[model samples]
Target: MFEKKVNIYNVFELRCKTTCYFGVGAIDKMRDISEYLSKRGMKKVIVVTDPVAYKVTGAWDVVTKYFNQFGIEYVLYDKVTPNPTVEQIDEATKLGKEFGAQVVFGIGGGSPIDTAKSVAVLLEYEGKTGAELYEGKFTPEKAKPIIAINTTHGTGTEVDRFAVASILEKEYKPAIAYDCIYPLFSIDDPQLMVTLPYKQTLYTTIDALNHITEASTTLARNPYSILLAKETVRLIATYLPQALSNPNDLNARYWLLYASAIAGISFDNGLLHFTHALEHPLSAVKPDLAHGLGLAMLLPAVVKEIYPFVAEILAEVYEPIVPGLEGKPGEAEKIAKGIEDWLFNMGITEKLESVGFNEGHVEKLTELAMTTPSLGLLLSVAPIKAEKEVIARIYRNSLKRM
Candidate 1:
């Protein structure tokens, strides 16, 4: 068991290994990017993405042209969705196998980039689907060389070891093999996210916000992670509204993108919390609501209820951002409440029913959320007891005008 009760005051050891490059037109750096990893007998390549990224980043055309120029044969799989499913992964794996593609390039936002991670693992054992990677059987050796290109500000899932693949209704199981970490490289160019729609601007920022803040207040929270989380929240709070207000402003978009990436790293350093664990099931079922929107709707309630449970951790997390509030009585609560209000202030909060979940589905949804493996990993920290009833409370609190 990785869980151990320890003094929360200890300085925790932080581990991170992904190489990240951030800039305005970093996509143009692709040729150099490809050469650094694609050297030593280039194998058949696959680019996993969606039509939106192809159109938005123009990376598909640009990259395909490069692959062709280098005389390295490649295939394109753009059928990825927001909450990528097993069927999609299976189909993508089949295409990769048919092409004999050994290198997978995930290009776009977290969705396609995340899908690319799942595809690389399952494609190694084509006919087996998510089965091969579900349990202890999956490993780095089973994965093809994967590369990530970021086109959005949310889900630094591009640089992390987590891949969420939906097998059925409102259900996603992560394909987590530690080797899944080395996806060759990640290319982050803020310009790609600049033209993104304002609605995406809002929701994806919510995702980043959850990643940073949740990791900060997570039970096994570390000081370094808390600091990053605080800075991340401040960055998102500072930049998201500006980007929303001015969609074409590259600098605003750049800062927001970097904040998202920082939050992603915070999670990679091991603080993904209950908000993500809960939000996945919401989107896995609704399909219509964007993942970011789902996070927007669910997080604040979790924040309100769970924040007090992890107050000491959260105090450290919020201190760097809110500064003056830590030592004073009631000030920490004030800061935490401010964080929640700021989420609302930035339009990151919404009614769950407005997105999809209604009273009709609450109990079962809550039941599954509590029992799912994701919850086990999350609750291992805080150990949310009165388990079934606590979920009931979360469901009721999440209720909005339907």
Candidate 2:
């Protein structure tokens, strides 16, 4: 087993900078944003979103109606796509600048919210392109205020200071984790989530589960983060299936939203490990792959690889995820198996091969993973140190169906 002595004098700090308003009718809080913008003398605002889904689901109407009633001048930039690209961020930034937008509102899942974060920052740094931001060549001292309204229960981009942008030219997906990118405020309304498709609900909830699992087992795990992670795991393990079975179950939807937020806060503070490091490259190679699906395919194998080094902590996490499994023999393996079974039951039984990831693609994926800037941070926090070959092996293992 891997072990290290703790230095008692070491110092750490925790800060979740966004103020969150969460509930069923939480969308009503847009009135608060109107007042907030009015106080700041902000007239023009921009709303970033995925045009089709948000429009069909009526989330767009809810936002625009509030802006109109408040007499807030707003422009809609609804070109955001899944795993948003740098070109898309630059395009949205151009629109925000043309409209003289002062505040940004992101009303969807992670892609729109992340695009909004990148746009908000780029707006502050005049003449800087999204590519420059992704390349670390330009850093903004400030970002326009963002109000993140989450319609999905994943990617806690609503509360976190991180935003991921893909650069296809470079074939890389880099996460920008500047403090300035944190949304000024976040709204989590379960009512908006009721419209989410069953597949999305399942995938997003699993994404939240992976966030908690990876965060809890990382080197950065602290008491505060661990408490949040444990509660998040327990809630998702119990409530996710209930919400899936009956999409109209408001209570289950509310808890899933709460768990998603908690998992976001946990991972925001505790960081992540190999699961994310390995998963990012897959999506970078194939932008069409949903992040949660890639995570579902890789997490069990990654956990199994690291189980020997972090068995005790995995056992602790297992108690909440699988009741009555704590302190049992082979608890680490049992926890990993439980997660695999959960993903299988959720209909995410396909391997990387199902997504066109074959053994032939392993080299390219490994190259991308090795070059990712976040990989260094992830590996540092990982329970076991992994070499490039080890990472490649994990990718190969993910190709095998459970």
TM-score for every candidate vs. truth?
Answer: 0.87, 0.92
Positional deviation of 71 in candidate 1, in angstroms? 1.6
Clashing residue pairs found in predicted model 1:
146-183, 170-284, 170-285
The models' CA-based lDDT, in order, is 0.69, 0.81
Q: What's the residue-level lDDT of 132 in candidate 1?
A: 47
Per-residue lDDT of candidate 2, residues 1-402 (tens digit)? 010242212221123689877776677777777778877788799888887666765667777777777778988888899989999999999999999999988889999999999999988988899988987887677999998989889788898888888988777887778889889888887778788889899888888888887888899988777788778877787788889899878778877887898888888898988888888888888899999999999987887778777676666675655556544435556666776777798678888988898999988888888787656677778877768788888888789754
In candidate 1 the C-alpha lDDT for residue 182 amounts to: 58
